[model samples]
Target chain A: MSPGSGPHTAERRGRPRDSGTDSAIIETVLRLMEEGATIGALSIERIARETGVGKATVYRRWSGKDALLVDVMKSLEETAPPLKGESVRNDLVSCLEFARRRGLAKRSSAVLRNVLGQIHSNPGLWGQYQETVIATRREAMHEVLRRGVHTGEIRPGVDLDLLSDLFTGPLLARAVLRPDGSLEEGLQEGLSEQIVDTVLAGVAPPPVAGG
Target chain B: MSPGSGPHTAERRGRPRDSGTDSAIIETVLRLMEEGATIGALSIERIARETGVGKATVYRRWSGKDALLVDVMKSLEETAPPLKGESVRNDLVSCLEFARRRGLAKRSSAVLRNVLGQIHSNPGLWGQYQETVIATRREAMHEVLRRGVHTGEIRPGVDLDLLSDLFTGPLLARAVLRPDGSLEEGLQEGLSEQIVDTVLAGVAPPPVAGG
Candidate 1:
């Protein structure tokens, strides 16, 4: 083996990768996740049972629980359809509504919340999942904020990072804390509207309300 | 018991209710919590071993794990001291700092996150804990926002509930999602300042420089 060869090349020289079985396992995991089974509750045995695969086959692919779970999360991450629009408001609304519909679905929400809690305890899974799910969302929102800046709709000096947090952080906080796993009423209607207003108006005493 | 008896009269029926036993149990739980123990992980025997109280005593007070956990959460809720002073800025600053500290504490944050996960699976515990901790914080923040409206610090038309969510939600979201279990540095220093500016200015397009 050449010292300069990368891991990808190294793997290519070995036994051929089986994309079919890999995708099948990941699909099953995500489907079970959509059905409200978390990694904590649904063990390797359960997955084997549900997928009708031997335990050795599962263990052979993913080294352990964390690896398997990260793969599952990675597979689900791609399902968020890409945004398509020029309007910043439209972009934000589309992304938030997607999160609201997919992440907040009754079964998926429970499993995802459980996954989030587990991620805290398992650092590797947390890092991979956060970079994929949490960071991806922030980046998408940042692009919208950047567009607003270009259009002169938002103030130029506003901190983009903080603005992103201020925009999406509320939805996450409300979603995770809610007992019924639902966003607040009017959330869909007014989130971007209020955010735009606040970013423009500043939070000091309002100027005479145009009276 | 008379048909017309009032709660105030009933409150005086017993010796000051001690309230000390509650404190003892809560403190014990907090100590265990800081050590990264969960209710599912906590055993009556272990708590008994630590507190030097008989298992019977613990059971006599709390019916089981959920009941004890509810009280433990109640104790943690007390850590968020109520806001004082009349200035909207002071109230917000104090409240946000309190949440930032308490929610970001290494041990407390873990336990609370665990409890939130368990709450979904256990409905009875969810109702009580939410009312005690979540509702208490909401009410406290509600009062502060109300003051902001009256004192002309915040715009009158802003939705009090959404505004409260807006201000505190980011703190909670960052705490649970971030790997570091701490408030983001920018938020710790400038969240309150930015919020104060945004609430007064609104996120609408600014009319002038630094407006």
Candidate 2:
């Protein structure tokens, strides 16, 4: 079956489906969620119809609706751009801004809540989802914060884990609590700035060497 | 037929049922959740049988499982005592201690996650839940932080709302994440100290405040 160094080897015998099949499926799921199709309401048939893929293909890759949605969410967890500036304030602003820009989409929040709901009932999925998004995000921020501490920009005694949670908690709470399923944009930024200012006041200790 | 200040009254006619009814129903729901009844598995019949109350009586008070569970959760919300202490740290320690104790219960986290799942789907109940418990707890903490700021113990610019959320977020994330469904005891004191120290460092302006 090995064709010699040609596009022919990549091509399959079936009618050529786009190589972007995975992206298409994720997009379809996101689009469906954006349009208010909840996780409980989503079905493979609907996704297949939306993406123009056959049911058999989706089943082959993902066992069911929960699996498909989980994968779609995982795909969104690509490395968020790194913190932009050297200062703690700038780093936090960048972090919050990233959350604001990427985290607050109505569709994403709904899907997140729906997925969270599923996790409560399904133990197998909980660890994977938590590890992929929640833990991964925290780990990245922890690294950035540790760097800040090492550079004498942050105080020595701060609990990096607790501080990181404190930094992001309000935004997450508001997103989770609101029934309209929209993050109040102005509120998010304002709250982010407030938290940053507060933490900076506490964490950046007295000058040590390079004054 | 209203009683005219007599020993026998219409209110007393069903007084026996009314007196023990709420407690009996709540106990049933709590037992089910403790026994690992998924939110979907809770039923009026189950409660009726457990409480030995007629199904009609259960329906009369609570429209369905959602309403019944909501009422049951409301009863538990009374567990978080109001913040009362001489200082912000004292108040927060007390408040967080409440969460720590609650988190330590074998069934507490599961019960909470189940309620959260219900909250995500049921908007009315969600609002009610937040208004009764989440909002109350945060507001009390906000008052504590606000006092701290006024007394110049906390920085003037501290975002009280966001700070409260920061204090609570990790506890919540941990509550949902842990399979054992309780917080490790050390984390309670450790996180409390971390939050107080972090916030104080920021809010206590330098001898000559930095730009």
Model 1, A1-211: lDDT tens per residue?
Answer: 6552322322466865566767777777777765545566668877876777888777777766667777666656645567775776677667666766654555555545656667545767777767877788778778877887787666677777666666666666667766464464554566656655554445223355536
| Residue B196 lDDT in candidate 2 | 63
Q: Give per-model TM-scores.
A: 0.76, 0.77
lDDT of 2 by residue, B14-75 (tens): 65336367678878888777765656556788789889989987776666778777767666
Q: What's model 1's lDDT at A69? A: 76
Worst 10-residue lDDT window, candidate 2 chain A = A1-10
Best by DockQ: 2
TM-score (C-alpha) between model 1 and the true structure? 0.76
Candidate that would win on TM-score: 2
Give the residue spans of candidate 2 off by over 4 A: A1-58, A178-183, A207-211, B1-24, B31-57, B82-84, B104-108, B119-121, B177-182, B185-188, B205-211
**Candidate 1 chain A: minimum summed lDDT over ten consecutive residues — where?**
A2-11
iRMSD, per candidate, in listed order: 3.1, 3.5
Question: For model 1 chain B, where is the 10-residue window of minimal lDDT?
Answer: B3-12
Q: Cα deviation in Å at residue A84, candidate 1?
A: 5.1
Candidate 1: which docking quality band?
acceptable
* Alpha-carbon deviation at B177 in model 1, angstroms: 1.7
**How does candidate 2 score on lDDT?**
0.67
